[model samples]
Target chain A: MSDADFSLWVYLSRTPLLWLTVTLLAYVAADRLSAALGRHPLANPILIAVLLAAGMLAATGTPYRTYFEGAQFVHFLIGPATVALAVPLHRHRRTVWRAILPMGAALLAGSLAAMLSALLIARAFGMPETVLASLAPKSVTAGVAMGIAGSLGGDPALAAVLVILTGAIGAVTVTPLMNALRLRDYRARGFAAGLAAHGIGTARAFHVDFMAGTFAGIALALNALVSAVLAPVVLRALL
Target chain B: MRGLGGTILANLPRMIPGAALILLCQLAGEAIAHGTGWPLPGPVLGMMFLLLLLLGNDLLPEPLPTPSVTGAADGILANLSLLFIPAGVGIVGKLDVLAQYGLGLAVALVASTLIGLAVTALVFAGVARLVGRDGEAEDAA
Candidate 1:
């Protein structure tokens, strides 16, 4: 490459703006493609965007840390975005309140099942204890899952990865599986999606329907509480 | 389109205070959770705090910044999926673990997530039916 081109590359790579722009552009492209495909479950915008961004980083030989310096701005929003969920929850308070009994029951059952199933499966496969701990809270959102995993003597980063994967799997499967079960109750569908997949599933729920989205947010919030307390307790019982 | 864009731009300034309120709630939540050794995450607590304000907004003499926060929040939540991409990309860097335990990890994640979803969904549906809320949920839907 020419010196001028190389110099330009060096400057752009170091700037946070470049990767930040790439993250947005990649999401735009993915969203466009997903929309084109009628927002099919498999055409998940996140899976597409992450792959696109990761591919560009690898192709350009950019370090993940350097890329994150720019992308972290976007990542930081997960916190406020979470807090913003209260808006919808408040708006749909009546619906949420009406479903309170079901929500409580589902939250306990789902939280326990989600944590226990992963730990049991991982153990049967002979995964290490630390890895099991990391896998236990995979259903919680990334930030909370990371903390829960860390407290349980697991690798937080590993927990984060598992959480994302679990979300994607749940997001993709929720619609088809719910349809097959003939479940027309958006509340039940959304509650399950959020309970099992956290934010990613909640994101998918929002796309499918509004009521579903609100219930998903409620489930997400409640599950974070349940899983945090439950993960350590469940781990102790199993170990 | 142009008019909507202009409106969004005009309303952008008002969003700041509302956004700040959200951040403040999150900050207070963080302090409480960390200080008191709570198991809950700060943002989740912040969510509950915001809900309380919303519920009691009528009781306040001047009213809280509900409209502005709604605008800010809707904007944030609408584009929520975009926020996950950065951390999602971190996956590429963590490929070694994926490489070594691909099968087990794959099975564990998929199986657990699906089982959890099905169990929770069925339990909710079944319990809601018994509680007579399933019909209401359907009618509401």
Candidate 2:
């Protein structure tokens, strides 16, 4: 409010450190809160952090681009973290290898279902071509989904948002849905969540159990691979 | 001065090899995808590459020292969800598009996701049963 205070705000906001610190602190707080709440899927730390960061940015009138400048460091780690998924897959090699047939079948079926259902529902609603394209890869991880969306003439940014929402929705609904279906297998549960929700879902699976988390990671990678190849081809034929 | 700051600085040098290995794999993946014009993302390919490297190491006469690799990878995986927050916040920027197509998008997302999850689980369960794997029972034990 005061002139000195206003000057300080401008200087602080201009630095990359502000957003970086904010993102880290917000996520840490959300992680603790999620833990305190017993890691319920609805209390997803990423979801909470996103809300908190977005709210802070909006309240301070800081542009998303400015916030991203600092936050991109965290984003850059996704690549390395993705590569790290290989560690778990390596650990669970025998299980994955033995179930290769079932996993493959599920991947193909799930990928097609994800693409077709989105395309049909969006088409039925008479959404635009771009929106339809964006929705096609909604079940894949954000990075791969966005790429697929872009190639299919969809809005990549919208695809990213849709991917996040799908992950959140999948995380929240998976436990109840699986329980309702009497699905007790961690492999089945984790794979289903990964196929439906991608990274966030995989994270939720990990929280549930170590074996589940391992399969979820496997599913996340394979689903991304399968969907990337299938989405554009299917969209071409359908749209 | 010799406390938190020095300890972190001391650890910094040790973290580089692990971080570098990950980055190198990612770069190789990017290069391969770029060269082959594959539809896959570099990181995804990079993951496959890392898997192959690990597999290859499995057959070696003497395994390579990879403390840094495990350290870096574990550190990153431990907080993997944090990486998603940046892009997630970009949702705030797309409010207009969301406002326009919020209903359609919501319907499609929720419906397709549920369908995908259900179908995948049923199919997997069925196949596992046929194979007599009883993955659920195995996991429970």
Backbone clash pairs for candidate 2 read: none
- Model 2 residue A57 lDDT score: 97
Error of 2 at B64 (Å): 1.9
Taking the tens digit of each residue's C-alpha lDDT, what string does model 2 give over B16-101?
98788889999999899889998888889999998899889889999897667766676667677888898899899999988898
Steric clash count of candidate 2: 0
Error of 1 at A136 (Å): 1.3
Candidate 2 residue B17 Cα shift, in angstroms, is 1.3
Q: Give stretches of model 1 more than 4 Å off.
A: B1-10, B60-65, B136-141
Clashes of each: 0, 0
Q: What is the DockQ of each candidate?
A: 0.73, 0.66
> TM-score: which candidate is best?
1
lDDT of 1: 0.88
Q: Taking the true A–B contacts (Cα pairs closer than 8 Å), what share appears in each candidate?
A: 0.77, 0.77
- The estimated TM-scores of all candidates read 0.96, 0.94
B30-72, model 1: which lDDT tens digit per residue?
Answer: 8899999999899899888988888899578887557788988
Q: Give the number of the best model, judged by lDDT.
A: 1
